[model samples]
Target: MSALWTIFRRDLTLLLFGAPGRGGALLPLLFFLAVAMLYPFAVGPDAKLLARTGAGVIWVAALLAAILPLDRLVEPDLEAGFFDQWALRGIAEEGVLSLRILAHWLSFGVPLMLAAPLAAGLLNLDGAQLWTVELGLLLGTPGLAAIGVTIAALTAGLRAGAALGGLLAIPLAVPLLIFGAGSLQPGGEGGLLLLAASSLAALAIAPFAAGGAIRAGRE
Candidate 1:
């Protein structure tokens, strides 16, 4: 537990606060809000419409927001040779990626879930649907992080890699979003359960792929 927190704090501080001028701090948060806000405008001002759409809107926004930071993840650390030092610590690179992703989820995904109320308000989501949205996010965001991390590592070198990461992520994540968004609809609890199952499955599989990608990036 202490080791986990240490890794979490170290990765978080390095990515966010540890930078010289606080460069990346606001980018993730603003990206989150902006993506959430787009729904009402795009779908019109009808409350019912917003409520129905809000769940999907927020889920997609959360996903995009969650993914945005991943592009920068290994770039700086790899450039500075953190992985070289990390490699000698008797821990596999996958273990390192797992720690970092968990911390990133805590810093990024948890707040996205916490701020879901803003999306609810904007979209006028009812109580049950709001709960559905929340539950879906609770389960789904970790999947998003796991999958997003893998894709981020894969695209670490290309110029448009970050954008491509998001693109690749969308297809892989479509099912989660479908179930997550559907969960907010009437009689959609089944979908949330499916979403939870899906997320768990993703978590199980994604790390190995991400670990492989990270190793390739290192070499």
Candidate 2:
């Protein structure tokens, strides 16, 4: 229990504050905001158009933002032998990975939600649209986080793993994107339920999948 707490705290700090070569939490937030800011200009100043497309744009931005930290999520620690050390101490990779999913979500998911209001304004989303977008992000980002960690673990030992991880994550994330954006439409509340289910499913599978990948990497 104590070791798990320590691992969680360490991961949270590294993910939130970043290390010398890593971009940390700030990078994703900036990228997400940049997408929001540039989108208005790219699509012109038609308020209705912005409002109409803004929620989907936000969902896309959040998805991309979730991708930014994938390279650092598992590879760094794996390279540094932390996984081995934890194994020596009888720690299960699944438990560590589950905590890492939570930590990853905290590092980017929560921040995206917090920043959604600003993004909403930039994209000309009304209050009701903003609310739905926020709700969608809440239910969907965990799935993004889970997918991110799973990809990170799967590619941790590969050449150009980061690029490959991003490529893999996009297709896998389409379900979340579909449901997340779908939730913004009128009579689309069912999308939220689907989104939540997707997120929970990812959460359930990520730890075991990532753990197996890590174990395979060790052999």
Candidate 3:
């Protein structure tokens, strides 16, 4: 319990309270906010058009925005030899990884998810559809965060990590994005059910997979 809180608070402080001056963190959050706003600008100015594109725009932006921070996900620990130190501490590596992921999700995922409703307004979502978009995103984004952290962890120690992280994550995330975005279609309630299920499943499975990947990297 204490360890979990310790890791969570440490990452949360870095993610939410860090000075904007730091390049290792905080920059990606700013990017998230900026990308979320671009949809209404590039798509169209009309409210209907904006609403039409709003869910997808915000969804895609949120995915991309959160992912941007993932590149540094484990690179710092690996570079600083903190990974080695942790491994030597007789701690279960999975707990460390899970707590770190939870922290990262809290710092990155929770905020973006919270901000989605407001971004929906920017996208001009109708009141009714706004609720739908919120439902879809809320249920679907944990899957995204899980898959993202898994893939990011896989690629974080590699050379050309940014490009490789994109390569690995883009394909995996497509399904969630599809059904999640599809949920916004008129009479598209089917996709919402699937996306919601996917979210739960991913939450169940992806963390273990991410833990496996992290453990494998150390071997």
TM-scores for the candidates: 0.88, 0.99, 0.86
TM-score of 1: 0.88
Query: Would you list the C-alpha lDDT of every candidate in the order shown?
Result: 0.76, 0.96, 0.72
Q: Is candidate 1 or candidate 3 better by lDDT?
A: 1
Give me the displacement of residue 154 in model 1, in angstroms.
1.6
lDDT of 2 by residue, 84-122 (tens): 999999999999999999999999999999999999999
Candidate 3 lDDT, tens digit per residue, 1-219? Answer: 775577667766765665443343455556666776776667668887777777787778767875776666666666777766766776665676666666666766677766767776777777788788778777876777777778777886789987888778877788888898898898888999999888778677766787777778878
Model 3 misplaced stretches (Cα beyond 4 Å): 19-29
Comparing 2 and 3 on TM-score, the stronger one = 2
Task: Please provide, for model 1 over 1-219, each residue's C-alpha lDDT reduced to its tens digit, 9 standing for 90 to 100.
Answer: 665466667887765553663345456767877877777788788887776677778877877787677667766666667776767775677877887778667767777777888778877888777777788889888888777777876887778887888788888888888888888777778997898888888888776887788777766
Q: What value does the lDDT take at residue 79 in candidate 3?
A: 70
Clashing pairs in 3: none
Off-target runs (Cα >4 Å) in candidate 2 are: none
